[model samples]
Target chain A: MKSREKEISKIEEVLIRFHRRHETFQAPPFWTERLMARVRGEKMRGNGFYRAGAVVWRFASVTCLAAVLLALYASGLNVETPYEIVELMFDDPAGLDLALLFASL
Target chain B: MAHSDKETQDFEIIARIMGGDVNAFELLVERYRPLIFGIVMKHVPYDRVEDVAQESFLEIFRSLGSYAAKSPFSHWLSKITVRCCYDFWRQHRNNPEQVLSSLTEDSQQWVDTMLAGRSRDAFEREASGREAREILNHAMARLSAEDRMVLTLVHLDGRSVREASDLLGWSQISVKVRAHRSRGKLRKVISGLLDGRQESI
Candidate 1:
């Protein structure tokens, strides 16, 4: 009798679930059409936007690498310049010249 | 004149949608609207439900191409819908409280009296059922969004704790604990509401 009662309860739950499902309307008619259009548009938007972004990123990376290379070459090539020589003198102000010390010796 | 079979998985429809078949996505929209609407309606005001529901669909569409088919499509779609609903909720300035839904014209009165009366017990239960549901609904509104969602999915929707966890993208342990706690909370709130209702009567 207890087992029978459990079965009855389970059936009641199933009936409740059935009522819930039956009572609600699904999507309205026109929304489905609208959603389809929107989905297509969204897909197009993703492809268009992301592709454009990818191109921009590629350009940016290349530009960044080129700028770094140019900076390195410019600094490396500056060793023989008069301004560089003066800048070196200023850079070593804490150290005295070896030639002046040798002449005194 | 053909409707897509409901039994087919989402990935199948999605593949067609990507290949530029617009109607495939329509099938998807039809299939999931109720599920999406259920989640969104809980978080948003009546004014926002339609638009937010649409936005949730859009979000799903926008990200559909990136869908990896790892989880079932419904689970993935549910996460997007929940996030969209939350965003709508967050955008509201007045500290938002969730409310149990009452019927409007658009609300489906799904319980047909004829069928509902088929079982004498159910018929007797029906009059009191709405009151019970109403109490639970308002009581549910006072809970946190996560708790509200966990409760709805498990109790109202009749999903397994595991399925609810999947729907919410929550871990099994967390889902179980939340479900247990939310029930206790609901029980307490419901009893209070019932007591108050009786006193008022």
Candidate 2:
């Protein structure tokens, strides 16, 4: 048992020394620059996707709004007062009649 | 006091990076490059150390937002570096022949002496520092990536099993079992190398 312990100790010492010897490494001066450039490239690529998505979303939103207005106009609804049309489209006509009756009174 | 100061500084830098200040990340890279490179060098071949180290940093940066700062930044960085090394070995695991053929002449001699069971004193006196490193590296290359990682962390780096478990995301018992098995495998490899060398002699 004692001999085994001694062997283990010797191995541990050797390993510790070996580990310490490798604690310092010399990286090139431009390593940080290269890494930064790569990171920036990654960021730009990510932003490209984000910007493309934003543009698509904006275009789709505008197109949808325009389509809705075109449909309302084509249906012979008033295009100048779009909210009134929207209210008439969505609200109960009885509610609108009641609101108009109140306004008249 | 010093530890907390470092933690605070790391937190500040991390916040800046997450806030989209790209330049702030350079400070982190400069501060930890040696540490990351040193750990990476232990697991990878010398020729590939730079590439592996860079990959590790890139991984760390990409995952920067997920860093909880619950542990020291160095510890968290080390976990990423170790995983990078593991990934490297996984990609190159089939190329054991390449690793064996890359050893220097001096390292080959040192391995012969170690296999012969020479006294530690003799090894210390006779082996060049570079040769010692090479022999260890060669021995490590013979083991699986998991074995190399567990042995280096638990035995060589003197990390506790709990620390290793946390770093590896393994149960403590699992780490202990793997560590024991890895040490035995390392010793067996050394003995086998010595036997092969003796036959060649």
| Best prediction by DockQ | 2
Worst 10 residues of 1 chain A by lDDT: A10-19
- Quality of candidate 1's docking, in CAPRI categories? incorrect
Chain A of candidate 1 compared with the true chain A, TM-score: 0.46
TM-score of chain B of each: 0.64, 0.81
Q: Which stretches of candidate 2 lie over 4 Å from their true place?
A: A1-16, A47-105, B1-3, B96-128, B196-201
Please provide, for model 2 over B63-157, each residue's C-alpha lDDT reduced to its tens digit, 9 standing for 90 to 100: 89789767789999999998888888878778755556345656557655544577768756544367666657766877777888889889777
Give the root-mean-square deviation of each candidate in angstroms.
Answer: 11.0, 7.9
Question: Candidate 2: DockQ?
Answer: 0.25
DockQ for model 1 equals 0.16
Worst 10 residues of 2 chain B by lDDT: B189-198
